[model samples]
Target chain A: MKYLPYILKHLRKNWIRTASTIAAMALCIFLIASLQTVLAAFYGTIDTAATDRLITRHRISLAEDLPMAYEARIGAIAGVKRTAKTNWFGGVMGSSGGQPDMRNFFANFAVDAEPYLAMYPEYGLTDADKQAFMQDMRGAIIGPALAEKYGWKIGSTFQLESIIPPYRADKPFEFVVRAIYSVDTQKYPNHARDMMLFHWKYLYEKTGQRAGVGTYSLQIANPSQAAAIAKAVDSTFENSDTQTKTETEAQFVASFLALVGDLGLILNAIGMAVAFTILLVTANTMSMAIRERRTEIAVLKTLGYPSALVLALVLGEALVIGLLGSGLGVLMASTLIGNLGSIPGLQGFGSVAMSAGLAAGMFAVGAAMGLISGLAPAVGAYRANITSMLRQV
Target chain B: MAAVDVQSVRKIYKRDSQEIVVLDGLSLEVPEGEFVALMGPSGSGKTTLLNLIAGIDRPTSGKVIVSGTDLTTLSEGPLAKWRSRNIGFIFQFYNLIPVLTAVENVELPLLLTKLPRKQRRERAMTALKIVGLADRSHHYPRQLSGGQEQRVAIARAVVADPAVLVADEPTGDLDAKSAEEILNLLQTLNSDFKKTIVMVTHDPRAACRAHIERHLDKGVLMTTVERHDVAAPVGAR
Candidate 1:
C-alpha cells in the first residue's frame, strides 16, 4: 500500500502511452471475444442437440428427396414410434433488387405437421397452437424465428422466391403462414432467425405431384434401435437407382457442416495466434514502463525500502494495466454484443449474445497478460544496487 | 565517539576495457560533531572514500566502520537500512525527484519508517524548517532555485535524524551566491545540530570552511589537518 503512490506516479509519468496501450488491448480483445461469440453460436447448435430424434434425408443428399409414400412404410416398421416429413421450400425474399434475394439461401422447410410437433417437444408449443396449425387447409406453421424474420403471424401472408432448380427469373413463390411454432432450444438457429414450416399437402398441391420429397424426420420407440433402423431404412432403398446414405439424425445435422469445410479449424488457429499477439504487445509495453522506472526503484531502495515492497509495486502496476485493458475489452464486447444489431459484421448474424463464460475467459486472459508482462521488470528492480542506482542521472 | 571510520579502503573500476584503481588503502576518520571536507583532484578517490564511509559502497578489501557498525560486514539490504538510519547523503546533482514537492522529497526517508502519513508530513516540515525552507514545502523540486533544491536535499538527508551527513560536491552545480547559502546551511546542520558532516569537493574555498581538511591523491590520503591544524588541505600539505 505504501508503494501504491510510486506505481501510480510511474503510471502518470507516461499517461498517454499507457492509456493508448490499454485502449489498443481492449479493442483487440473485444474483437476476439465477439468472434468467439459468433463461433460459439455456430458450434453451440451441435453441442446442444437432442439425441433421441432422427432425420432421414434422400439416399444421396439433403437437396434430393425420398418418396412421400415411404413415410408410411417407415412409420409401419418396428420400433418406429412417430415420424415427421419436412421439405425445403428454398424461400428467398429480396432485401434488394441485386443481392440474390435469398440471404445465402440458409434454411427454410415444410414439415409433416402433427408428427413434427410430437417428435420435437423441446419447441414448447401450446396445444392450441398445434390445433390452430392443423385445422386450417391453407394451414402453414412457421418457427418463431422465421416469423420475426419476415414479420409473419397466425394469419400473416408470406411470399418468397425459390432458390431451387426451375428458379424463375421473374416469379417468387408465396405461402400464407398458418401459425408460428416455437423452438425447444437453439441449435444453429439461423443468423437471420428464420425457421419455416408448411403443410405437406400445400407443397404437394402447389408444386403438385412433385418428383421427390425433401427429408423424413423420425422419432422412435426404442432410442437404441436408431442405428439399426437407420441402417435398415437405407438398405431398403439401396438398389433403387438413387443411392442412399442414411445416417442418424445427429450425424445428419453434423454433416451439414461440410459446407464450411475446415474453415472453422483455420479460424481457431488464427484466434490462437491473435491471443499470442495480445500477450506480446501488452508485455512489451509493461516491460518498457518497468525499464524506465529503474531509477525510481533504486531511489526507493536507497531510502531503506524492502525488496518485497518493490516486487509488489511492479506486480500492482501490471495488474492495474491488465484489469484496465481486460475490463475495457469485456465492456466493449458486451456493449457491442448487447446492441448487436448496430454492429456491422454482426448484423448478418442477428444480435450476438455475450455469454458469461465468454466474459470469464477474457478476464482470465487479461490477468495472465498483466502478470507475464510485469514479471521481468519487477525482478530487475528487486536486484538493484542503491549505490549505483542513485548515481544514475 | 567517532561517527565514521575508514581504514585502508580500496576501490577499483573498469571502464572501456581498462582497469582503473580509484581508491587504494585510503584511511580517514571523523569524530562526532566534526565537519570535515574531502579535497582532491578529479580522480583522487575523494568521492570513493565518502561512499565507503556512508556504507553505500563496499571497499574491495579493508574496513569501513561507521557509527559502531562495520559497513563492510553488512549485506546490501541491511547496509541500505543502516545507512538510512545512520547516514545522510547530499548528491552533487541535488537528486530530488522531479515530480515530488520539497516536503514529499524530504519525506522519502520516512517511507522506510512505519510512521503514519500525518506524522511523516510533520517530520518532513520540521526537516524543511531546519534548512529555512518550510514555506517552500509544497513547491516541487523543479520549481526551486539550485540553492533551494540543495536545501531540500539537505532536509531529506537530515529528515531521518541520521548520525552522519555525507555530501558529494554539494555546491558543484550552484552559483557563487547559491553555493555560499548551501555552505551556510551545511554549517548550521553540523555545528547547531552537531551532525557529523563529511563533504567531498574540489573547490579549495569549500574546503576552507571545514573544521578539518583532508587531501587524497593517487587513490590514497596524503595530507590531513584539523582546527588546531590547517582547515585547507592544500595549505596543510
Candidate 2:
C-alpha cells in the first residue's frame, strides 16, 4: 500500500497519457455494461416465470382461440387447480381524430378471473380482492407501474376508449379502474410490469364474437404436476376442431421471447466484444507505462526493492485505474438503464436496475485487468541486471 | 580479512561471435577500512573491476568475493539485496533519478530497510549533512550544479550505511575546486569514519590525495603504493 502514493505520483506526472488511457478503459467498461443491461433486461423477462402456471394456446397459432367451455374440462383434471382465458387484445391507444398515441400498455381479455389470479399470485391480489374482481362485471385491475405510466386512478373511468377498439378502429372500449396493485416479486408472472386486465364478458358479449378464448391461463394443484395437467388440457382439446399446445409458464415465456427477440446470441457477442476491447486498451496502457520505466524499475531493483514488490506495485496501479474507470462506467450505465429503458422503443424490456451480480462481475473483470497488466513488466524487471541497470544512466 | 577478493576474474563481451575481453583473469584485494584508488587509462578494466566487487556483475570465470560471501555463488535475488546493503556506488555522471528530489534520492536506499518513514527521512537528512548539501535537500537533481549533483549522489550512497563505497570517478565530471572538495569529503569519510573506499580514476592530481594507490594494467594489479614515491614514474602526469 505504501507504493500507492508512488503510483499516484507517477500517474499525476504523466497526466495526459494516464488520463487518456483511463478514459479508454472507462469507455470500454461502459460499453460492456450497456450491452449487459440489454441482455439482462431480456433475460429478466424469461426469469419471471411461475412453475405452478401453464399456458394453453392454439396448437397451430397464438392468435387462434378455443371454446370457453374447455376451461372447465381442463380445470377438472386431477392436478389442475384453476383455469381462465384471455384474448390478445392488441388495441393500442389512439388520440382523437383517428391518430395513434405513443404510450404502450398491456391489454388482455379475461372471463374466468379466479384462475388468472391463482396462477399469478405475484400480481399482489389477495383472496378478498379476487372476490371483488370476480363479482364486478365492469371491474378492471392494473399494475401500479402501469397505472403511473398512464395516469390512471382507482374509481376513475379511464378510457380504454382510446386504446381497446371494439373490433373496429372507429370504436373503443372503456373501463373503471377498480384496483391498482404491485407485483410482490421483482418480475411479473405474466408481463413483468406493464399489464391491465378486466372481465372478458364485457368485450366478449358486445362483439358477439364467440370464438371461445385466445388462451387459457392455468394454475396447477402442485408445481410438479404441471406437466400432467398440461397433457390433460391438450388431451381435452385434442379431438376438438381447434387443438391445444400447453407448456409451463417459464417455457412459455422463453418461447415468446424467442419468437420476438434475437437476444440470446446478440447479448453474448456484444458482451464478449466489450470485454475484449477493454483488455486491449488496458494492456496497451500497461505496456507503455512499463516500457517508459525500464530504467526506473532497474533503479528500484538496484535499490533492493524486491522484484515481487515491484510487480505488485505495477499491478496495483492497473487495479486502481480499472476500478476508478469501471466504477464511473457502472454509474453512467445504471442511469441509462433506469431512465431510458422505458422509452417507446425500449419499453418491452422494462427498467434496468443495477444488480449485485453485475457489480461482482465488474469487480472480477477489474482484478483480471490488473493481473494482465502486471505480467510483462514483472518479467522484464526479473530479467534486468542490477549493474547494467545502474550503468543505464 | 579482505573486504574484497577478486581471483582470476574474467569478463568478456560477445558481439556477433566476437569476444571483447573487458577483464581477463583480473585479480585484486582490498582489506577493511582502506582508501584505495584504482587508477588506469579509460579502457583499463577499472570500472569493470569495481562492478565485479560491488556485486553488480558476474565475471566470465573464476570468483569475486566481498565480505566473505562469494559474489558468483549467490543468485540474482540475493545478490541485489546484498548490493543494496553492502555497496554504495557513486557514478561519474551523478546518475540521480530525475523524478526524485535530493532528499528522496538519499532516501532510496532506506526503502529497502525496515525503518519507519520518519526515521528514513531523518537519516537521509543526516547523509545530506555529511555531503554539506542538507540545505539543497528539496531541490531536484536537475536544479543542482554538477558538483551539487555529485554531492547528492554521495549522500545517496552513504544513506543506507553500506559496508563499502565504490566510486567510479566521482570527481570526473566536476570543476577543479568541486573536485578538490569531493576528494576532501572522501578523505574525511576514510580517516574520520573508517569507511572502506574504492575509487577508479585517470586523474593524477586527484590520485595524489589517496592513502593508497593501486594500478590495474591489462586486467592485473601491477603495484600498490601506500605513500607518494618520488622515484616511481608518474602514472599519468
Candidate No. with top TM-score? 2
Q: Report candidate 1's interface RMSD in Å.
A: 2.1
Native contacts retained per candidate? 0.38, 0.46
lDDT of 2: 0.75
Q: Backbone clash tally for model 2?
A: 1
DockQ of each: 0.39, 0.43
The DockQ-based CAPRI class assigned to model 2 is acceptable
Native-to-model Cα distance after best TM-score fit, residue A32 in candidate 1, in Å: 3.0
- Inter-residue clash pairs, candidate 2: A110-A200
Computed on C-alpha atoms, the DockQ of candidate 1 is: 0.39
Quote each prediction's TM-score: 0.82, 0.84
- Local distance difference test scores for all models: 0.75, 0.75
Best by DockQ: 2
Task: List model 1 lDDT by residue over B1-237, tens digit each.
Answer: 678888887788878999889988777789998999999898888887887887767788889889989888888768777877988889888878776789988998998898999999999999999888999999987789999999999999999999799999999999998888888878777767889999999888788778899988989888886765432222111
